[model samples]
Target: MKQRLDKAGVRFRPHFKTHQSWKIAEIFSQEGIRQITVSSVTMAHYFARQGWKDITIAFPLNLREMDSILMLPEDVTVGLLISDSSTASYSFPKSLLKKSVFWIELDTGHHRSGFSVADFHILTWVIDKLCSTGAHLQGFLFHDGHTYNATGIEEIREIRYNTLSRLSLLREFLSEKYPGRNFLFSGGDTPSCSQELPMEGIDEMRPGNFVFYDLQQLALGSCQPEDIALSVLCPVVASYPDQGRAVIYGGSIHLSKDKLTVGKETIYGVVCSEEKQSDMRLTFPGDLPFLTALSQEHGVIQGTAEQILNLVPGSLARVIPVHSCLVVSNMKQLVSADGTVFETLNLHSVDF
Candidate 1:
């Protein structure tokens, strides 16, 4: 991964929202990753406490958290995303304006937020206001979130091209219209970042989920099962041979209900008997396919009576989550490779 970014001449400022561990953050810091991206203000604070000097809250700046933002250390360089609203421009405390860096987000392909590339007049107006405040207009940042919906490599490539084209056009417009204005062009998504990066005009890339990939990335052809670094461990509680089903302690509370379906086949989660065992095999038998039908306090596994009978009640099962981000966020704690329990990090004060 480092070699790939080095070859492209693009700096990597990995998003730390995937694995919110201070230990992992230190690893990146030691690797010379000075700058990092996060999803919330609390995350910024958490990593900042862990000794991160530069942090960018990729989401829109929260107007209500102005006081909390002000309390951060002055040496900690902070960047906030600004969009159509002048709220961030006007609401930000005048004292912090000089120290704060504002990146006008551009909506290239994903219609989530930010001023659209086509809305040149409004974008320029926002930039003018931000520049007037003397707050450093730190380039542009965007995420090609729509890449997740891509069905094949061709679609992924098209999304990448369109996103880059849009961003380049906007950058060129900014350059010609306002020359000598220093700025950085940054964009990334797990799929596009994992495949190949085209750093024509981009200065930085922020890929979050690559640290702990999941089934969604696998289904999208982004990464293989070997790239997946996390899974849920659940103990089989019961086996109903008559109904060809078994129940596990892991359910919606442990592993989320998110599922991936390809044609008629549905894979809720990949099952393994152990975590440390490298030769761990998934529990789907040849004759009876395993499926997680319902999940609450129990994960209902479906298969043939013979296959169901084979699973012992006291056995342990490891289930690979369909969406690692959501599953990890839901978990309050995680066990490391050595079986040490570490509390899961939380950024959002309110549950999403």
Candidate 2:
């Protein structure tokens, strides 16, 4: 992934929020990935303790967490995102605000958290407050998350193009209004970055999920089936040959409940044979089972009666998650391709 980004001349500052493991981060460090992106201040501090100096808290600034945000280690250079004028004007510690770089989040048609390009009022308003408060405005950043909903490669390209076009237009406006200030335009989703979509004006690409593409990215044509890097190892506890379904010990709690529409059915994951996982090469249109349904602690695999018979109790199945990010958050540990087991700090960990 870093090779692809370097070849494309795009700066890679991957979001580490996907796999919150310093050990996993060590691999990225070995690959020379210096900049990092995370979802929260707590995560930023976690990585900071691991000696990550350049970090961006990708989520919008939380006014309530000013105490913790301000206390981030001084050795680290932090980047914060501001989604609206409210966060811009929110009471922030001037010391931290001055030291931190700020990126105004652009909506870019996602309808998620970001200032709309059509409404330059909010953009300029936030910029004005940043200027008044002496906050370093690092420029605009956006996430073309809508691309995940695209049907195919062509549709993905179209959505990404339109989103980038809006960010470029807004960039030009910012350039003209604030003549001397340089604003870096940053944006990317897994579908855009992994597909190597047109990213002419984007300064840095933060495609976290590209590290571990999942069923969703596969369906969006962002990655090949073989490119998927992680899967949940589940044990078959029950097999219903008559119904052509098998029950596994992995479910929403382990693999996440995110669903994707593949063909006519909505599924939570792709169930590949444990043998296939050992090979680490997944073929397209392969004879893998689909997870038809999921409960809190159980997953139902759909397959033919004959195929279901193969999943007798005590057997294992590898489930490729629909959303790697959410799945990783739910998991407490991971096993690398070479069979190296490492622990992960579950960002959303809770005691039952």
Q: Model 2: per-residue lDDT, tens digit, 234-278?
A: 999999999989999997788877888766678888777545643
Best by TM-score: 2
Maximum-lDDT candidate: 2
Residue 173, model 2: Cα distance from true site in angstroms:
1.8
Q: What is the lDDT of residue 285 in candidate 2?
A: 32
lDDT of 1 by residue, 208-281 (tens): 89988887888787886677888887788998989877888887876777877745666677664343334433
Off by over 4 Å in 2: 274-286, 347-352
Considering only N, C-alpha and C atoms within 3 Å, which residue pairs clash in candidate 2?
none
Predicted candidate 2, C-alpha RMSD: 2.8
- Alpha-carbon lDDT, every model: 0.77, 0.82
- lDDT, model 2, position 80: 91
For each candidate, give its TM-score against the true structure: 0.89, 0.93
